[model samples]
Target: MKNLFLFLTLLVLSVGVNAQQNQIQQDSTSREKLDEVLVKAVRVDADSPITHSNVDKEELAKRNLGQDMPILLNYLPSVVTTSDAGAGIGYTGIRVRGTDATRVNVTINGIPYNDPESQGTFWVNLGDFASSTESLQLQRGVGTSTNGSGAFGASLNLLTDAFSKEAFAEISNSFGSFNTRKHTVKISTGLLNDHFEISGRFSKIDSDGYVDRAFTDLKSYFLQGIYKDGNTLIKALTFGNKEYTYQSWFGLTAEQLQQDRRQNPYTYDNETDNYWQDHYQLHWNQRLDNNWSTNIGLNYTKGKGYFEQFKEDESAAGFANLIEDDSDVIVRRWLDNDFYVINMNTTYKKNAVEIISGLSYSVYTGDHYGEVIWGSDLAPNTNIRDRYYEGDATKNDFSVFSKATFKLSEAITGFVDIQGRFVSYKTNGINSDLVSFITDAEFSFFNPKVGLTYQANQNNSFYTSYARANREPNRDDFKNGVTEHEILNDIELGWRHNTNKVALSTNLYYMFYQNQLVLTGGLDDVGSPLRATSGKSYRLGIEADASIQFCNSFSTSTNVAVSSNKNKEFKASIDGALVNLGDTNISFSPDLIIGNALNFFPAENLQLSLLSKYVGEQYMGNVDSEFSKLDSYFVNDLNVNYEIKPKKLFKSIMLSALVNNIFNKEYVSNGYYYTYDDTWSDANAVTTIEGAGYYPQATTNFLVGATLRF
Candidate 1:
């Protein structure tokens, strides 16, 4: 730790000496006149008084190997990442400001990516997506209005690679610990006859995870075509994912972890998850005039998947027609869903004011069913086609929003945004409990936001904003009859300073929630989530980040967040009784998070970096018991990259290596806890026993890669 501080000090001194000679420059002449159709609907304009960060392709390429998107964004402010495979490869998840994935809104271009029912972004379904992305923006809190679900916590918008003016081809491959391997191929036709361009990429990745049987096999592809004219641009694209991974959801208990953290609880050979997803999108942007611009986008997605699990000593009566034979069973749960969306945005800009309006309509249809594929010898007549339950769900959503920005003065700006949304959801057939039922609901919401930005000077600025957002319950919430609209009132105050060598930003936010759906670590047989409202909750935090350019070849970036999350008068169900836990800390919310990166270029073509992260302790249960806490951990990584200009054989060649968790620290990043009644222990009474499972992280791991471009 002392050495790290010393290095930071020297770097800062070096940066001061070179400040007058170095300045980040922007080329306005090369900027696009019209934004991509998919992103325009949700993105914020300049001087909008919103806090956001943009990540470009160059930042992604340094570590673009087999890891998922969440792992790549792990160093961002207020972000916590976890992986079920014990490594950053398959089934990874992220939480922003302690808010889980279900609350984070994700979009590709401008199209929604979260599952309508689960409200979760499955990055595995878009294998190697980082390879095709050109840029991404992350907005924190109840940010600007967007399509599909609301941004209750944060929003992630991704833009695919743009058309290249020059033709190019590239090949990349990587191999690493845990038998991990990745291969990718990409090409672009550049501009054809000065009017059209085509680009495509194919990728495959495989890994034997740190945990036993946590294997993953993934394949994906992306293809896009673009047509451009003087003031109009049109694009069409398709992407898909195919994945098969063994079940690693069942985590470890304290005793089991002590024996071996990598132990697998279940010994079934066929326990695995298989899935595939495909997406098609079309976008058009037109510059009607100097003051008017419009964008339109249409998207369709198809997804199907299933996970198989073995039940021990299951009740035979749960099967459709099986008798009570007191035998074990193996079952599979399947999901097939279809989603359609249409989004449009129009912007009018004149003088110092800009007005932008957007409209979006989306529909989703999903089928959920379970089948008993195998049975114990006592019941030998089982077949693969016998189903236990079948259910269907459909949702229709529509929204319209308008935002106006006005320049109040030479250094001050005012903004206003209003949105109206309508949602209708219905479900029929059997639920997780095998109970046949039918339910339907509708909701209407109006959200408003207002803010002001004060550009005190060229190098300093200050901003503040207030916003309100409402969200409807998801499928899981409906299954348990907690279908109430969740509401949030958010406030933000921030300041930013920028110069030739240093940039700094600090933001303070307060978010109040009504009837917030909080996770209880409970899951259905199929691993679908189950949540309950906490009645009242709030989160208050301070976020600060800074970056310094030491010289042409050296720089450093760091971010830190401190927060307090709490539930008012929390209550829990313990052995069929309501237990009040007064003013308890919210589960899974850490009070402190810190991230740092130190980069240096020892030579003109060689670069090296060190990344560090620290997360504070968090509780897994609302009661905040010591037994349910995940201890704080600090981890670091080392990265190196070298580039070569081989004029004879290839246009350029690059090599990269990443050593993760260099100290090999043993830690648990995530966990789940639940308490159940043990009536058998005392026939006349019930004993409440608490059970917990921990997801241990990998120690030291490495990945080495090479890229060839021509």
Candidate 2:
């Protein structure tokens, strides 16, 4: 498969090279329009009734030193980010509107990026992806119908760097706290004879994280070839990463945190996670006529990895016929998977009406296995590479959607969307617990959405929308005995006001759910969160954001969100009995989140900005116990950027720096809570004992970088 992909890539490059000899003249306007078509099916226009935010390359570059994408987006409205290593380089996660990453749908150039079985986006697998992105759009709430998993909380879509018209080369290097460093090199062939272009990037990042024994090493690359003529565009791209990170998922307990905040519990020398993933994509866009256009996308992804661990006093039966009843052992858990996807979409725009229709299909296969490499005692029949537990899974997903927009009148616009999705999942074999685990499930869902926009005047616009979404349980959810599908009904109303120096947006949302899968604050063996079905829940909130230019040298951007999240008539199993919790707060849902940025443009070539974030206290479990509460935190950062244009030997020289947690406040951003019934200690009456663990954030850190472009 790898050879086939390589051959196809070479073929596309050859075709582009051969066509470049003809000296074809291209229109920049047409090229821009064609580039937009690649992601139009999964995105919304500014005039649409959806609530969204757009981030471009220029905005991302200021803090693009070495952090992951989630950390760069931390200042966005209603966003919260966490890093397992106490820094922003490895094993990072993001939550929006109090919803976890698994509920966020992600796409790259209209191809699904979330894992099929887990429905989670692993940013570590695509290290330094922000360097290759041209622009990204984040839609809050169930705003639109998209491919792969349903959008329960938000949808994020990214477009890779566009082909350049002139040849260029760039080198970037950065060094920061925690012995962290990054090196990057990029080159572009530009438009050869105005018909072809090629570009590529390579990056390496290393960090000795703030936490003890938490280190990361990453290497990644991106390559693409493009051919354009008239109204037709063809692009072939490939991107991948290899990562090795020390284990840090096991967080610190309260008592241990008090003793030492940076201590690591695991002392084994070889405890680490190693993974590699690669993606291949081909996109073709054509304009059929003046009012018709179409786009086709194909994607193939291959992933394989393993994490090693040392177990103490494992059971003989668990190790598959071990000679001793209790012995120490070292094991490795592996996951190998293959995914293929195809997407097709067509658009028609004429007069006051525009319509878009698309279809997406995907197939995924994975093998899950564990092997016992070394044991304290072994039987004569035991081989060196004997498998202890093994399993395989297959999943198929298909969807069809159609959306339309109509200018009902001079000031009012109407939108409608409909989608049908079908999925089938099957798995078989023994689980790691030495028990049989088999599953075969199928689901068919129909979702619909409608909205209206009213442009009252040149500076004021009002919009309202309602949407429905349904999602199936992921692999870990199934393992935790949760089998029911979840459903959400969402409604949003907003108003936008724009002028020369001020831009403001305010919105109200009410989301009602049936059989919602809420996090239980408990992690599985591999650190994936466990979830359970809540009978009924709702989230009601008001969000406001603004960008104001006070004068020629100063400006400000700010956003705030206040919400009420609850699980109505909640129930839980207490000491050997069921208890009604009665309208408890949902886990991990904070009431208030605020973000602000104050920018100063002292000169045309220099800029300075101060960013701040505040997150309110929230419960880690649905029961709202004092033990599950995470304290509120307020943090600040400072950023500076300076540019110099040279007349000779270079196009530009850029210098950037960032100081995080400037106040040096020690805070914990994420944690887990769990309860277990103790029957053995108290035979007469069972007692439910509660405990919690926390992940601490770095106190103060800095990163500085310089880029030379020619």
Tens-digit per-residue lDDT, 146-253, candidate 2? 999999989999999988999999999999999999899999999999989999999999998888889989999999999987778899999999999999999999
- Off-target runs (Cα >4 Å) in candidate 2 are 1-32
User: Model 2 reaches what TM-score against the true structure?
Assistant: 0.95
Error of 2 at 395 (Å): 0.7
Give a tens-digit lDDT track for model 1, residues 44-145. Answer: 754468877778898999998789999999999999999989888889998998888989999998999999878988988988999999888888898998
lDDT of 1 at 624: 77
RMSD of each: 9.4, 6.3
Please, what is the TM-score per model?
0.94, 0.95
